[model samples]
Structure formats: C-alpha cells, structure tokens
Target: MADFETILERGGALILPTETVYGLFASALNEEAVKGVYQLKRRPLDKALNLNVASLEDILAFSKNQPPYLEKLYQTFLPGPLTLILEANQAVPSWVNSGMASVGFRIPSHPLTLDLIRKCGPLIGPSANLSGQASGLHFDQIQADFKGQVDGFKDDDFLTGQDSTILDLSTSKARILRQGAISKEELVSALPQLIFQD
Candidate 1:
C-alpha cells in the first residue's frame, strides 16, 4: 500500500477510484484539502461533495441517525455503487455540507480506494474531472485534467466509468435523487415493498 498518510499529511488531493467513477480525493475534515478539491474542480460551494468511508463504522460516525430503512439499505447496497444522503453530524465541515446540514456518504466498492481510505480515513470526493467536463473513463483521460492538482492517480483498472446511484435516506421515506450506474430496476428489486418517492 502507498503511504496514504503522506498524501494526507501533504494536504494534496488524490485521484481515487470508486465504483461509480474515479474521484478527486481530499480529507473530509481538512478545510484546506477540501478547498483544494473545490478549486481543482471549479465546483460551487452549494454543491458540497460526497464523503466516502472505508467501512460501516466510518459511515455511522458521520450520520446523525441510523434509521431502520437506512440500516436496510446499508445491508443491501453498501460496499457497492450507492451513495446514501443523510443528515450530517458535527464531524463534517460546513464546506462539505454546502451549509445544508446534511451530507452524502458511501463506502465505495473499488479496491485501491478502499485500501487507501482504510489508511487515510474518510474522504471527501467528487468525480475526477474538471467541473462541467465529461466523467473520465481512463487514466490518460484523467491525467491532463488532474495533472498536479492531486497527490496520486489510480487508473481505470480500478475505477468504473459511470457514477453511482444516489439515494436520499435522510427523510422518513426513501427517495432516488440520481439514477446512474445502479439501475432503478435493481434498487426496486432490492427493496420491493418500499415506494421510491421523488
């Protein structure tokens, strides 16, 4: 394993692989690192970003509440291509929350990312491409875009070419906010009885 601490300690953003797509990574709790990601992507503050954890324990740490439906979703969809939108706890920064008081979290299903995150702890991540650009499908595609902005880059041998399915689990009822790599059919099948509000 690479020295994840070196990456974190240096405060450089990293290009990490995720089940959805390659992500530009930074310490979720580091304001400078988080700001660097926003600068690199040219993303707006209101967009915030998603936090990717390496384990279920890490996920629980950032959430305000772990409702029954959320637990069920974790049991079924985690360590895969799913992002759970939930109420943020105090550990998360306002920059990450976009001042919304809630955040999206996931345990990505890419091996290199899981390994690195296990070492570096939870990460704030966004697609590894410049804001408004197409999602990168290969390492070479990401190289020019990321270049010196991030500390390290992992190729597509680890990253999937599409984004994950984002589900808002913050409310009492579940809802699908974005449909991407994970199909609606698969999600509906996973929880057949539940209604997909919005």
Candidate 2:
C-alpha cells in the first residue's frame, strides 16, 4: 500500500476503493489537490464534490448548524452508505462545494477508506471515472480510466458498485437527493417525519 498520508501531503490524489464504487480522492482542505481531481476527471467546476470523513467530529468541523434529528440519522446510517448534506461552515473550502452553501459528507463503512481518512484528514471523493462516464467499480476499471491520472491506487476486493444514498438535511425537512445503497423506505422507516423532495 502507498503511504496515503505522504501522497496527500504532497498534494497528490489517489484512487481509493470504498464500500461503494472506487473514488478519486484528494485532501478536502487542500485546494490545489482538490483542483487536481477536477482537472484529472474533467469534471465541471460548478459541480460540487462529496467529502469522506473519519468521524462525526470531522463532519461537525465543516457544518455550520446542527439540525434536529441529525444525531438520530447519523446513529442509524453513518459509517455506512449514506451521505448527508449539511450547511457548510467556514472550515470547508469553496472549491469543494463549488461555492454552494451546503456540502455532502459521508463516513464510508469500508475500513481501508476510513483508515485513509483518519490518516490524511477528510478527502474529496468523487467517482473514479472521467466526467459523464460510468463509475469504476473495480481496480481494473479504475486503472483503465485513471492509472496515470492519480498519484496512487489502493486496491480492495470489496465494492458494492453503488453510490451512497444522499439525504439533504440542510433545510428544516429532509429530502432524498440520490437513492443508492439506502432506500427512501429505509430512511422513512428510521425517521417517519422526514419529507421526500420531488
């Protein structure tokens, strides 16, 4: 395995496997590194990037407000395949959110991903593929798409081949942005008062 902390500290990006699809990762707080991910993926500057955090405290560092029921939601879905959108605090760079007021944060259930985040701080994790392409679900696919584009690759055999379920908790009511591993019914089952956005 590559020294992920060194690679990130040197402003390099990595192709990291998660419980979901492989992701192109760079230190979320490192503006240059984050920009490199955008450049390599040919992703639009306006599109926001999701962050991978090691813990709830990491999420709190970038969150401006603590919404009601957030703890309950986190307790039920965190360290799994759910991504939460929360109001961004000043700690989060504008580049990560594309100047948006809110940002998406996830704590992947994969141990390797969690370890890397713990070592290098939160990471900007976008699907490891060129813009508009399918997400890379395995190392071979990632290598074919980004072998030369990233600093290093972390190999893992486990992958769910699906992105996290995204929930928008930045507002008073919860809204499902993207359904993946976690279903709307599952979320509603946990929090019946939650509202779904059309």
Candidate 3:
C-alpha cells in the first residue's frame, strides 16, 4: 500500500509480510521510529522488539557475547525462520530492548522481508497484530490493528499463516522461548552439543 524506502526514510513504521506473519517494521537504529512500532502495535514499553538484518555481517556489529553455540546456531538456522536473543552491542538502542541490555534479532527467510531489510538496512519488525492477539498474515487480517498506524501494507501469498521459532542465545544456555516453524527436535539435533534450557 506504500513505498518501503519512503516509510523508513520518513521515520515511519511499515506493516509488511514475513515468512511467519505480517510485521510492523522500522529502522533498528531509529529510536523514534522504533517507538512508533510500540505505539502502533499497542505493545507495552517493557516488552522489547525484534530486528531484521540484511546479512550475517550486520549481526556482528550488535552481538557482544557471541559464544560458540550461538555461532553454530547462526550457521544452522539463520537466513531462515528463527529469532536469536543476544546481548546487544553499543549500536542497539536501549529502548529497543525495553531498557534491557539484550535484543532479539532475526534473519527471516521471506524474500520480500529480506529485500526490504537489504534496502533500508537493519529494522525492528514487531508483530503486525496487536499485543496478545493472533498474528495476521494478510492485510485484511491486519487492517483492524494497523490501518491508520502503518505507512504501507503488503500481502504476499507466502505469509498466509506462520511464525518464527524463537531461540534465546544471550547466556551460555540456549533457551527455546517458543516453538513455531522450526522444530525443537531439529534444533537439538543440529546443535546436539549445546545445552537446552527449560
């Protein structure tokens, strides 16, 4: 419904499709724009947000404590449906982490999301639906929550209904926050050596 670059350039959040579902995106480094995402989602300030980066190299800049397990996880699941919560580097905003020291980051498998991130650089893409609601995949499903808040809306067939697997790699332990598209069994099999937390 709107231009991707324009929204990011104007410091506005965008509602776009991901491999999982629709997400509201803003520049990861733009504090004001990131705040706008919270307002649009009606999400609380303390919940924190998720970031979509252009490439693996982009992550190195914001990942302070990249343990060997995380590196293995990156190699195994990145450029796919997974979010890695890690301790943020200096470049990440405190607000992005809800004043916490860590941030959740993802490299989505969706072509459009990747393309947009490549264009605008890194961005924060909170869920497109309202807080504590069903995440939408189509614009019609999302219109109620974000009709007025988002600068643009894009609905592709790929993101009809799915969600990313969440992995917390901030500490020495790899915690499975939520199991979505990526199976817990597969993760364990890939990183058999890494410890899994309850």
The model with the greatest lDDT is: 2
lDDT of 1 at 156: 65
Per-residue lDDT, model 1, residue 24, is 84
Off by over 4 Å in 1: none
Cand. 3 Cα-lDDT: 0.80
For model 3 the local lDDT of residue 69 reads 68
The residue-by-residue lDDT of candidate 3 on 42-94, one tens digit each, is 78999988778967678887778776666777888888888888888887878
Tell me the tens digit of each residue's lDDT in model 2 across 1-198: 458788999889988888898888899888999999999999999999988897888888889776767778888888998999999988888999998999999888888878989888789988898999888786887797775778888788878898889888898777888889999999889988777666
Clashes of each: 0, 0, 0
lDDT of 1: 0.78
What TM-score does candidate 3 get on C-alpha atoms?
Answer: 0.92
lDDT tens digits, residues 63-151, model 1?
Answer: 88766556666778788888888888888878887878678987887777888788886788788888898875677878877676567
Q: For candidate 2, give the lDDT of residue 71.
A: 77
Error of 1 at 105 (Å): 0.7
Candidate No. with top TM-score: 2
TM-scores for all candidates: the values are 0.90, 0.94, 0.92
How displaced is residue 118 in candidate 2, in Å? 1.3
By lDDT, highest first, what's the ranking? Answer: 2, 3, 1
- Alpha-carbon deviation at 175 in model 3, angstroms: 0.9
